[model samples]
Target: MTYYWFAQSVGVLAFMVGITMFFNRSDRRFKQQLSAYSAIIGVHFLMMGAAPAGMSALLNSLRTLISLRTRNHWIMVIFIVLTLVLGLSRAHHWVELLPVGATVVSTWALFRTSGLTTRCIMWCSTCCWVFHNIWLGSIGGSLIEGSFLIMNGFNIIRFRRLQLRGIDPFEVEKKIVKKMEENQAAE
Candidate 1:
């Protein structure tokens, strides 16, 4: 009983970190935070005895971190293959595939998309996680996934609004780059 509560406590921490991830307008920061959240949730799932979900989450953490360095097609393919083999090997039921599916979709999004498109793809992943958490009886995980659905949807709309307004959602990055260039010229 105490072990169960401890695992739930870790999930609550993941919930907090995961919620903050959606608030990041910068893709790099979002991915960084997502990697951390995935690691935490991976541990949480493992402690709860959801082996497939736990392994998927841990793999996702590493995948997200590597994506920060490169989006090479081969790297993405390797991760996908690895995720499938490992996740499927541990899956005991059809429902166990939910987290594996979620991880696969997320891996694609992180490697092949960015900003608004990435968020849109992740919306699907979030849905899979919601069902997976419910099936696993993880109250904290379910709540976080549900929150991700709503918050991620709102962020997608926000990005679309910026586009409609003829404003780049990533304009801040451009400004930072220009400022750094100016400083270099001054030096």
Candidate 2:
């Protein structure tokens, strides 16, 4: 029963994101932001498809593993080993880390974005992830995503305001200048 409701909410959020992305398609700045946020939501889709309830437990275990200074590949190898061994042995502990791995991969990718536009969508991504995870009854580590989501929302809203108020454009040469530069360098 709970799973159904949770899935429904996630579906709605996904829909919201999709609609926003579509309407935003003509806007390049928003597209970049959407790309960044989409990465995070994409991870949520992975988690919701995987272990929706175990997100926190999985992330906690990941945090511990990451804290141990283990190399990423080795850590992944060990994780796989545990999954095959301990997991098959009925040790449920390591099996739950799947969602955490998804979250980490998603969040890490989102962190690579720059610019105010991207900074804004970053929050939406985290919120979308946490919103689903929270419904699954795990609050742990979600705040990290949620906090960034709020900050990003604020930044995005500010941008909308600036744009509406006719913000000044940063000057940069277009194709004509670039072509001249190329011709000069050729000479």
Report RMSD (Å) for each prediction in the order shown.
4.7, 13.8
Where does model 1 exceed 4 Å of error? 172-187
Residues 1-187, candidate 2, lDDT per residue (tens digit)? 6864564455455445443432231233343444444444444444455343233334334433342232244454454444344323332444344444444443333233323443444454455556544544433224434544555566567656666788722112123334444664676
Model 2 alpha-carbon drift over 4 Å, by segment: 1-113, 166-187
**Per-residue lDDT value at 27 in model 2:** 33
Error of 2 at 156 (Å): 1.1
lDDT of 1 at 85: 95
Find the 10 residues in a row with the least total lDDT in model 2: 168-177
TM-scores of the candidates in the order shown: 0.90, 0.30
lDDT of each: 0.88, 0.42
Clashes of 1: 0
The TM-score of candidate 2 is 0.30
Best by TM-score: 1
